[model samples]
Target: MKRIMRALRRCLAVTAVLAAAFSLPATDAFASPTAPASPTPVVGGKRAAQGEFPFMVRLSMGCGGALYTQQIVLTAAHCVDGSGANTSITATGGVVDLQSSSAIKVKSTKVLQAPGYNGKGKDWALIKLAKPINQPTLKIATTTAYNSGTFTIAGWGATREGGGQQRYLNKATVPFVNDADCKKAYGDDLVPGDEICAGYLDQGGVDTCQGDSGGPMFRMDDAGAWIQVGIVSWGNGCAEPGYPGVYSEVSTFAAAIAQAASNL
Candidate 1:
């Protein structure tokens, strides 16, 4: 789950430039794809059981995503280049282990990135698959109410800061950080309305890392249904104290996502 995407490095370069322009810390890194390396589980996370996350899919770019529809995947805009046809991208699902024979792989026909994404907020995007994968779809949260409490995050990304990506999916639980505290940690880099923050705060032993970008931060709703409230975006480092993981707040773009999905 490292830098598997062909354009991942280019996207990261753009991100670095944007961060510099805003005078943000160069230490801030996207929870995104990186150079290929050995595999490691998620930091402070447990290996996921098969079928535990049926909606989760591993993008060819080494990013993670959830099936938003039968043929549409909701991922981070940074995970893709832009809106256009791209048959080279693949979506692998139905198994926690990427190499499992039970896994299903589908090719993406196109990607629709969020308008005006400058490598910061507005990190969400959609990837349309060539065919529908018979699996459960993840429901995105449309209200900020679902943004609170302890949410679950899972991916094949590195288990430790600067560690390698994993072949088996892993997961962890992180508490939501209020906007005020999150803002203090990241300053102007933390987009209040456009993004959300979650982690252990002072502890920071649990969080997302590189290759986990575009993955879902979710929790069970009142009706016992999984609702995604955040999309992994960026952070200073994996599970670093005072630097909680930042994500694209789903509620802020819920309507646009639905509209985009319709057009896809």
Candidate 2:
């Protein structure tokens, strides 16, 4: 596989504070008992209620994210890769210090970001939780290509034009993108073993925004088990035509993630 392509404009676009710029051209004032408090800029990153591996962070603005799971808090290689002397980033738990905490404990003692993963492309990372993934099942895929068509990506990041929400998960849909369009959108930029291509060309609806990095791009089976197929790494403008969003194909890095998990 042509693993390396164009690197994500080096996370500049992904981490850019553009979400605050997202605004509707025209709209009517909505009504509410009290003025809607501006969306709180996610300080330690946002997340759903709570899950074993559910975690994410921004590498810009405040320029940091809180890791949730000690076992696996995925991240962009650029933000927390071998670049750091510590094999992977250190999280203190909670929304901030995801590395260590007596109250909020999640540990794997091992952090693994792809060795070759840089800001270039395919920036993927994995944290081997402290304990075994004894949950029911969240199967890992080893196939390099995405046979699955549709998938959903959720994050607690800023919307089209803003950020700062402490909670409340945000999401978008993604359709598989072919190599041709991938190159057109980002030529010689996709890094191998780092990034995989994905986005909607027809539906015109799904895309990843800020604060979405390190989150799962999951495929839903009839059984309803959300199988992680990709990781939200980066993308072009909020939503662009022809150019769909790109992700780090999870299967391609399954071995690394699995190996890291085994240590726990």
Candidate 3:
């Protein structure tokens, strides 16, 4: 009985460590051996139903994205930095469950990483689909609406830290943290203009974890339409107190996003 108890304790310890390192892709560029993990989807959230978030997309490269237009997808820059015309990237949408057959898959024709994206802020990318999808696209947040409020984030990332990717989409609501408080949390790691912070300071057990990178952090507009305010970028650990998840601030680069989308 003593040996069995010891084995159980070790398993619990491993689970805790895995939960702490929550980034989705687990790449060297975004995470170091000493740095807290970054990326992925909701931790402590409920599963989403089909068509709940119509714009949510699952990337073949282990990230989440949002459909900006019929032919364009907005995702994290790190997910497409080295990917080009030859890369076989696919974006699956229109389904909540990854295993469902109702998904709409589109191949990428080109990938455009934001200018000067190097695993830091401005961690956004635009993927041009080979064919346009017929679903509705999410509107970008152009004002300071994202500066403060309760935001909803969704993705197909791991349900827990250090776990395998989830088959069903998960959704969570988190409060936005001010830049001042966020700065205190991330210190020199925080990018003010390029990133927005969202999560609970009290460690309320609500946050995006691994496999959710590049997913949408959004809120409803005054008209009740969904507007994307941020893109899942990085964080210290999943749902850790004082360390809210950082996202690419959509308002900061709305013009750039428009230009890139228009050109394509």
Pick the TM-score winner.
1
lDDT of 1 by residue, 176-241 (tens): 999999999888777889999999989877888767888899999999989999998888777889
Per-residue lDDT of candidate 2, residues 1-264 (tens digit): 232222332132343333432221211111121424333222122234434334433332212232323345555554443532243223333332222132244333455567765456546665544453332334545775444587766654544423332234444556677666677777776554555677766544456655556656767655765577776666665455666667777777777766654553
Model-by-model lDDT, in order? 0.80, 0.48, 0.76
Residue-level lDDT tens digits of model 3 in 28-52: 2122324323333367787687788
Report residue 190 deviation for candidate 1 (angstroms): 0.7
RMSD of 2: 8.2
TM-score for candidate 2 = 0.62
Q: Which parts of model 2 have CA positions greater than 4 angstroms off?
A: 1-70, 81-110, 128-137, 144-146, 191-194, 202-205
Mark the 10 consecutive residues where model 2 has the least summed lDDT: 24-33
Where is model 3 poorest over a 10-residue stretch in terms of lDDT?
3-12
TM-score of each: 0.85, 0.62, 0.83
**Alpha carbon lDDT of residue 120, candidate 1?**
65
Q: Which stretches of candidate 1 lie over 4 Å from their true place?
A: 1-40
